[model samples]
Target: MEKKIVISDEQLQFLSKYLNKKFPNLSPQVKIELMDHLICGFEVKGGDDFYQYLSNEENFIKGFINNEVKNVKKTYGKQTWRQFFSFFTSRELLPITILTLFIIFLISKSISNKNAWLIFVVSTHLIMIVSAIFGMINKKPLRKLDEVKYLGAEIWLPFLMVTLADNLGFKNWLIQNEFIFTGYWFFTFIYGVSAYIVLRRQKKIILTKYKALLN
Candidate 1:
């Protein structure tokens, strides 16, 4: 039978501090993930002394951490896109999806084009603000859901699109052309909902994964 390695609380704290020095802006979730990985590596490498093992393999460990960071960033992007597309294609969500489209269509039709565009853009910004606030007000000791860090694309992509549209004079073009404006409005709403879904799903996963640690 393989011997089990038990990591003590003090040792865990040291690991945490070491990671902070290594990655000043590391997310709580990623910090925890890397800490677990380091402990497992220590066990497999026949280490009775964690600090000594880390010192002996300092260069290798740094390279490994760097690779893991890249892998995590890539995986996060892939998971987000997969979740966004899955939301649109799910059979169970089809009816609600249709209803949402209908509501957005009605909203676009009933309001003046310029007003509708303003509302869509403003609401998107408001959602971003609320999401940031929500992350800050979390009472958990370790806040895994840092909105700026995790949802960088979701929060800023729409704003960037709006900026690009204005710079390209698409805003005036969109408002002047009712058909195009309606389509743009629908796209904005759908994108916002998809972002919300991604945020909720991510928060759930992080909370579930770190439930014991949080408590």
Candidate 2:
């Protein structure tokens, strides 16, 4: 026969406060799921009365409290990552785009100086290529469903970097009046289009994962 476990008002209040503080926007469904887990935990502790269990096995109670704290910490960490993903998929690209523009500006200013512009453009391209190669080769597997969005970002970011670098290189070459590179405009157009597509795809994937977790 399975043991029945009851939680005290104090314990429930503590959990509620902790959950609310840690997850202010936690959905009611998720709250119920967490409560169910807590009930199972209480049952597994194995005692006729909750207070008796706590008093009789001080070490167990201590361990349980420690575990709960660790769980809360982990939850916060996950939450932080989810928030970061939101920013990364949307606003974080802005800095990279700006950096690419700055590089273009510098290259354009140094256009008359072929040697300097060539060195800068080549160095930037090489770095971007190496980064893309490494990112593709050393990509980690997604451990959680929520991490799928991150994985998708990883998959697309290299392509974005490459496109940005290619565009910048073409711009630099054009400024140098070398061979009249029109590919830069094409690459720039592609970069913007791809960025929008990737952002939307990532947003949908993340939101789906978030909804699944709620259930």
Candidate 3:
């Protein structure tokens, strides 16, 4: 025999709000079907009275929202990883590479001390390589792969400037003189821009994913 289930006004309101957000145009039959399924599931899960079940249901809804928030955060974290690798392979990594080469050239030109340059270059390269690898392995990708492509383009500017400076010998120019600390400012600007872009992208992706889950 199919058992009947009862729901409270509060539970009905909560479910209605949730469903309306997901399906603003949802048909009456569809809403009824959803409510029926939910009520049946709630009854099976062990609430004997409508009020008791509604209480439990409220808690369940709260927990569900909490979990969804966490998942959204996780999704954003993955997108960040994607951005990191994309940035690394695209342009941000180039400045470091150029800087290393410039350091080697200076060392060779000045003291004929290949060892010092070798150590600096190798250590820096290894550190960067290892960090990239670790980030790739440990970082999660945005839950929705399609959203990854929409990441804002503005984040690339700082990287572009840094690369340009390094390539045009401006970075070396700054390094040779103690008063030319403007390069560091530019670098800091790049970091700040990258962080802002990543965070903004994360927020957008998370909200989109959460809204999609309602349907």
| Residues 1-215 of candidate 3: C-alpha lDDT, one tens digit per residue | 76755666787787777766754544344456656766777767755555565555655544544554455456655655565445447686667645644554555446533353344334434433433333222223343222333232233444455456558876556445432433343343434334454656555544555454545
Backbone clash count, each prediction separately: 0, 0, 1
Candidate 1 lands at a TM-score of 0.64
The residue-by-residue lDDT of candidate 1 on 1-215, one tens digit each, is: 98877887888889889878866666666667767777888877775788997677678657765676666566556765676566579998767767866776677678887787787788668767765655322535444334324543564566666777789977887776766766676566556556666666666666676577667
Model 2, span 1-215: residue lDDT tens: 77566677787786667656654544444556665666567777756565454345446434544555455445434543454344337676557655655565555455564554455445434434543443222213222322332322422433454456457665444545532332342233234334344444444544555564445
Whose TM-score is greatest here? 1
lDDT of 2 at 165: 48
The 0-to-1 C-alpha lDDT of every candidate, in the order given, reads 0.66, 0.47, 0.49
RMSD of 1: 5.2
Q: What is the TM-score of each candidate against the true structure?
A: 0.64, 0.29, 0.36
Instruction: Please tell me which model should have the higher TM-score, number 1 or number 2.
Output: 1
- Which candidate number has the best lDDT? 1
The candidate with the higher TM-score, 2 or 3, is 3
